[model samples]
Target: MRRTFLTSMALSMGLAAGVAQAQEKSLTLCWAAWDPANALTELSRDFTARTGIAMNFEFVPWTSFADRFLNELNSRGKLCDLMIGDSQWLGLAAENGHYVKLNDFFEKEGIDINDFLPATVYNYSTWPKGSPNYWALPAMGDALAWVYRKDWFARPELREAFRKEYGRELAPPRTWDELMEVAKFFTGREIDGKVRYGVAIYTERGSEGITMGVTSALYPWGFRYQDPEQPYRMEGFVNSPEAVEALEAYKALYECCTPPGHSDAYMVANLDAYKSGQVAMQMNWFAFFPGILKDEQVGEVSGFFVNPRQNEEASVLGGQGISVVSYSDKKDLALQYIKWFAQPEVQQKWWALGGYSAHRAVLEAPDFPESAPFAGDFLEAMSNVRDFWQEPEYAELLQAMQRRIHDYVVADKGTAKEALDKLIQDWTEIFEDAGKL
Candidate 1:
């Protein structure tokens, strides 16, 4: 009788262990370390509370973020069960099967991709640009937007001076020419009894910072990476006279209007300059706007604008999408996390938590545009967001642009035409090597 009782106890223990193992599923998500990522970590507590699955995160700084995460993806590392990768990485991640296709899961879960903002759905989630080959979910909808000191713009004397000099109201600029004029007007000037520069445009020498910043102006000025119809015929398009002029304008803004040492500024530095009252205007991602609104020094005086236009309005698209790593043993759990994240309530909380949700439901909420100082500009900017290359060789293409543009813009090593001409040559060679030309 004692032997039989011991056998029953051991069987019950083994079954309980199996059930515990099944219910204890967990996942690790990796993303760039920023304010949004911190917010996400806080918001993810809800997911844990509801599902009982554990969540782990790896937050890497923006500078070496791509290098660290890409290496993990390339090696099929199980370290990251999920990743919030840049939109431009979609092409390579999908082509190499580093990401699990989310189409079937979306359909099965009844998560309508249409619920996301159209631009974000196209740029962040789709792999082939316009196709429905979904490999990720639009997590953050971002665009390059402007922040300026409204108190200065509203000053009667400054307004009169600006109107006298430029023959227009000193409101947020509507064109790149006006933007430059605004920048020029404020540089080295005393405002509120403190000297400040005109703007802090991205001129970082490393990585894709310069390209991302310049393209905000370039797209409206008629720069094209390649022939839209032929895709790889980039020679005349990338090096067009209009593109050269745009590059020249970008360099001019950086050299004459920005503060000293801004040649190395990127997102964080630009934000710091604005927060510290060192610049009258700064260009940054919409993701940073909430923090700016919370700032004590600049918040009360801050103003926001969509990217200024030349021939047409355009802003650089800046955001990432959440993806399930293809090699993840916890893919099902990761997918559950994404599904939970895609819900409307979660998206609303995402916004409340400092993440810029791409969900149309949240964005289209009647009060959304007026919810924050920059919300309207965010909506307007998304309407005309332009993206860089989404090719499998995008990193290589981006690196080449970084080198070419930084050398010309920051180092003043070449003319705008020379810089763009060299860029065209570099892109052509890249395509040729990839057998696309």
Candidate 2:
């Protein structure tokens, strides 16, 4: 009888221990497979060391990142306890309750949203445009920027020829027209007896690549979605003549300067072109700048600049915010991770590890802009950052854009005017279906 009782007690204690261990299990974070994700892995080691909660990551390629994660979220898969979602995903995620509203959690934990950059929070965290509803914590702060081969641009012979012909010094361009001229000069030019192309921009057809890349040209040339006082009234706003001109300029840049077989190019393809010495210049997200600055061949020769202006300086925002999956059973544990990440020290380490920290304290550090080659450009670009649609129907809208823009830019099927007109029609259909128009 005594032995039986002891055995039963021991079994109960063992089961309890098992449950406790399971409760303290590792967290899985999903994000795009890129330079920042690598930095995240390194930065997370300290979190694990302090909390004893192992960190697991799901790094999906950017091309398919949205499809994979959105499916996971919609299915309420427990695979990702935390996710670094794109800014445009906030509205859909929040509206559908896929992400936990962070307002109460942030306030309870004393995590001040003011500490993060206003642009980051507005674009990445908030829903309903300027509402106080917070669905995510800004993790990565990014914007479009230009990178060029400084060594080639600085060559006196090229500079002299450029000045003589184009009547301008061969240097980083300050305007899109000047950039086009520079790109023209470098296209198919022999550098070190090897022919290289001029520029590489995102032209990938099946995803958000083309839209994101083209917006660098779009916003500066006067593209606006709708009246600020009204939403879903996009007919004239989207297909305006200025917007048409911008898209034409974008397609022209694609045809004139990019390498052959560049139709499916995005982040990886652009990085490869620069790293392999295949292109003289590239336009990419600022988040990739840290990795570029570390590349052996490209780092020493490269110069960084904000995307050149057309009629004004503007850049497309490209970072993501970390959100807790609403269906996650481990919400408490996820909140713990958020609290840890919000600390100023951790944010500082994030930037040091090549992740762009959105925390104002870290970004505003007196030496922050000078900390890296593209740092100043990043600061300047973020100040003028603009975002695409931030509605619950964003995915539908983005897909429509991908189809229309790709048909024109990559497949060469139609003119910019026709493309934007079709885009306006498509967006109107989506808004109508959503009962917005």
Candidate 3:
């Protein structure tokens, strides 16, 4: 009897150990979790509950996201099992072959990717569209638009004053030109015995913040990076007549309205300014909008609208996507995640957690416009959003463009024409090297 009891106890212990091993192999996910990233994780709770996997999440602020992600990737599969990288990293990651191409898996799993917003998923998740493979899954919803002090806009005193100056009723400016008119009207205006600023234009050269802010203006001015084939190349369109025209307009607005040292600004910089009532408006991401509303300090006065257009409203289609590391040993598990996360139910959970949906159906859900704190504004404003270049060399092209434009507008270095011609020349050369020109 004693021997039989001991044998049964040992067998039970062995079975339990096997079950635990199968359940938790350990998963580490790395991402940028500012508001959007946070929202994605909240959406991921269901996956954790259902799979019984021991998941580890790695989140870094956007401030050092690139460096952090790059370092982790370079660590040779020790850093993470899953990664949701920035759109700009797509090319470099793909070129380096450090990411598991999901095309085969996606097809084998029968994921109808056609349901995703093509412009967004293609640009942010693929290195070169139509290539044999895709690199990641859409991780966040992104669009560029202006966030303003709606409470102030709705104020009777400000409204009357704006109408008197612009010869129109006080309302969201219909165009970029009108946005300037609005900025100038309230900039430096006396309010409750306090001084105020007109607008916040990101000017900081730190990281990619300034670059993103600059491109929000540059692209609509008809700036093209290179011939379509040579996407990585840059040219002198930086000083083009059109390019300069865009900068000149931007410069005029900056001069009269932006806070001091606005040139060194980034996403958070502008948010800080708006939160403090230092700047009346800023061009920023959809992801940040939720945070502005959540933070007690700024929620009282913040407002949002689609990025205003100069000739038309066109903002960079920017955001991040979820991907599996090429060297990840547990790729099947990661693919399971990608497939499950795309479900409408999962998307709705994400929405409830303050995330924007990547799918049109969820974005257009009848209750969405009314349920969340600011869904009405976001859904109404999605029409004006657009995608930036998602090619592998996307950052190189953007940096090249930023350098030229920053010099011209902030430093007053050269005629827009001179800068643009040189930029165009530079970009054309890059195309030639790529055999695209």
Q: Which has the greatest TM-score? A: 2
Q: Model 2: residues >4 Å from true position, as ranges?
A: 1-23
Predicted candidate 3 versus true structure: per-residue lDDT over 275-358, tens digit per residue: 887877887877887788777976867777766667655676667778899778887787788888877788777767777777
Q: Write the per-residue lDDT of candidate 1 for residues 4-64, one digit (tens) a residue.
A: 9999999999999987885567779999998899899999999989998888899998888
The order of the candidates by TM-score, greatest first, is: 2, 1, 3
- TM-score for each predicted model, relative to the true structure: 0.94, 0.95, 0.87
Clash count for candidate 1 is 0
- Clash totals, every prediction: 0, 0, 27
| lDDT for position 190 in model 3 | 81
Error of 3 at 58 (Å): 1.7
> How many angstroms is residue 287 displaced in model 2 relative to the true structure, after the best TM-score fit?
1.4
For model 2 the TM-score comes to 0.95
Worst 10 residues of 2 by lDDT: 227-236
Off by over 4 Å in 1: 1-24
lDDT of each: 0.90, 0.91, 0.73
How many clashes does the backbone of model 2 have? 0
Write the candidate numbers in order of decreasing lDDT: 2, 1, 3
